[model samples]
Target: MTGNTHIVGGIAASLAFAQISNDNPVLLVGAGVIGALIPDICHGGSIIGRKFSIVSKVVTGVFGHRSFTHSLVFLFLIGALLHTLLTNDSIIAGILVGMVSHFILDMATKNGIKLLFPLKITVRFPITTRTGGAVENLVFAALSLLSVYFGYEAFAGYF
Candidate 1:
């Protein structure tokens, strides 16, 4: 999926997290966006990868795109690391949800990810689309609007 779609998914996941958690919505959602893009860091053309080319290159060289980074092991380790480092459980939850959202979005693509890793099991939905294609764009738009609605609902009383 495109970065735009991943970002939307991330935001939506964070907002969803907010519905149950009392963390600062703004910080949680922001971290969600970052987490969503973190998986794609293995791709040289990814937004985060472009910003950190050396790290991206090294990761890609070692594991290749959509391999280790897209796996459950990576997600668990990252979540554990973040949880250990961050004091707020909500932030850790938001980031983990965001990263999971990324994985969910990628599962809708033709080239699925190795979710189990080491086992080489590629998981994908029967209904899939090309990356950045018309379907992906539609998904992105719908998710964007959903995120906005969720945000409004999340902070409705603030306004």
Candidate 2:
């Protein structure tokens, strides 16, 4: 999936999770965006990868795209790290949800993702689409709208 789609999915996931965490919506959503983009750090051309080109190159050079970074192991490790480093559990939960959303979204792609990693197992949904194809664009739009609705609902009590 494209970074935009991943970001929107992250926002939607974080907003939906807001019903439970009820933390700062803005902070959760921001963490969600960062979480969404973090997995793509292996792809040098990806948004997060471009920002950290050297790291991207090193990761991609060693593991390749949709390999280690896309794995559940990576997600768990990152979540653990975040939980230890971040004082707010809500933010950690939001970030983990966002990263999980990224993994789920990637599972809908044709190439799929190595969910297990180091185990040479690629996991995907029954239905799949090209990375940045029309279907992905539609998914992006739908997720974006969902994010808006969920965001509004999550923050409604504040306003």
Candidate 3:
């Protein structure tokens, strides 16, 4: 999926989690938004990649696109690292959840994802959606709406 899709999905996932957890919704959503874009750092042309070119180049050179960086191990490692650095459990959990959502969305695409990197196992969900296609865009849009609604509910104490 594209960056926008990942972002919307991440925001939606974070919002949903926030509604359930009743923790700091802002922090969770922030971490989730960032986490969503974190996986695409392998592509130099991506928004996050272009913003952090050096990091993107290093990560792309080391793992390439949709390899180790896209794996669950990488997500866990990142979550742990962030937890250590930020010392915030909620943020760390949000990041992991957002990254997992991204990984799952990618798994539904035609290209799929190397979920078990180094093991050389490519997992596809059989749904077979095209990356950045109209359907994906629509899904993102709907997720965006859901995110907005959930965010408002969380902020307004409607839950």
Candidate 4:
């Protein structure tokens, strides 16, 4: 999936999680965007990758795309780091949820993801779509609608 898809997916996931965490919506959504782009750090051309080129280069050099960064290992490691650094558990939850959304979105692609990495196995759903293809666009649309719905739900009583 492209960056936009990840962003929308992240937003949707974050909003859903917000219902439980009750964190600041803005903070969670912003963290969601960061989380969405983070997994793509293995690709120097990706949004987060371009921003942090040195780390991107190193991670890509060692793990390549869709390997370590997309794995549960990276998730927990990042999760641990975020837990230690960020005082807000809700923000950490939003970020992790967004990252999980990224994994799920990529899992929809033809190449899939190495969720349980260092094991050399690829995991994907039964059906897959081409990245940036029509199906992916439809998925993007669906996620957009979901984001809207979740967003409304999150802010319903407040507004």
Candidate 5:
């Protein structure tokens, strides 16, 4: 999926977390946004990649695009690392959830992803739509609308 789609998914996931946890909404939202963009570090052309081109290039060289960094193993490892390093449980959970959301969204695209990695397994949805195609765009739009609604609800303390 495109960066915008990731952002939308991130926001939606964060809002869901907020509803469930009822903690500080802003911080969870921020973590979710970061988590959404974190997986694309291997692409070298994504929004996060452009901002940190050198790092992205190095990672891409080592893992290649949509490989280890985009896999479930990587997500678990990163989540474990973050949990060990960060003191807050909410933040760690938010990041992990956001990353999961990103991975799931990417899997929905036509190209799919090596979600298992190292094992050479690729999972995709039956829809067969391109990453940034009309279907993805529509999904992004729906996510955006949901995000807005949730954001408002969060701010208003309506969950």
Candidate 6:
């Protein structure tokens, strides 16, 4: 999946979290965006990767794309680290959910993802689409719509 799709997924996930947890949407959405982009740090062409080229090179050199960073082990480790560093439940949830959304989107791709790292296992939906293909564009459109829906549901009270 593309970065725009990940971003939309993050926004949708964060907005959904806000509606469920009744927390600050701004912080959650911020963290969510970070989380969504963080997993793609292995790809130098990724949204966050371009900004952190050194880290991207190191991570890609060590683990390769869609291997360790896309794994559930990394997700849990990040969750733990974030929990230890930050006490806000909503923010943590936002980040984790965003990351999960990344996993979900990647899993839908033809290349799939190594959801379970250190195990050399790949997990994906039975029906997967090529990255940036028509199916992916459709997925992106759907996520965009979901983001709008979740945004309205979460922020309607403020409006």
lDDT of 6 by residue, 1-159 (tens): 999999988988888888778678888888899899999999999999999999999999999999999998999999999989998877888899899989999999888999988888888999999888998888888888988888888778878
Which tens-of-lDDT digit does each residue in 57-150 have in candidate 4? 9999999999999999999999999988989877787788889999999999999999999989999989999998999899999999989998
Task: Supply the global lDDT for candidate 3.
Answer: 0.86
Better structure of 1 and 5 per lDDT: 1
**TM per candidate:** 0.96, 0.96, 0.91, 0.96, 0.92, 0.95
Candidate 2 stretches with Cα past 4 Å from truth are none
Clashes of 3: 0
Q: Local error of candidate 4 at 56, Å?
A: 0.9
Off by over 4 Å in 6: none
Prediction 6 TM-score vs. true:
0.95
**Model 1: ten consecutive residues of lowest lDDT:** 88-97
Q: List the residue pairs that clash in candidate 4.
A: none
> If the candidates were sorted by their lDDT against the true structure, best first, what order would they fall in?
4, 1, 2, 6, 3, 5
Q: When superposed on Cα atoms, how far off is each prediction in RMSD?
A: 1.0, 1.0, 1.8, 1.0, 1.7, 1.1
The lDDT, on a scale of 0 to 1, for candidate 1 is 0.91
Model 6 lDDT vs. the true structure?
0.90
- What's the C-alpha lDDT at position 72 in model 4? 98
Clashes of each: 0, 0, 0, 0, 0, 0
lDDT of each: 0.91, 0.90, 0.86, 0.92, 0.85, 0.90
Q: After superposition, how far is residue 34 of candidate 2 from its true place, in Å?
A: 0.3
Worst 10 residues of 2 by lDDT: 19-28
Cα deviation of 133, candidate 1, in Å? 0.5
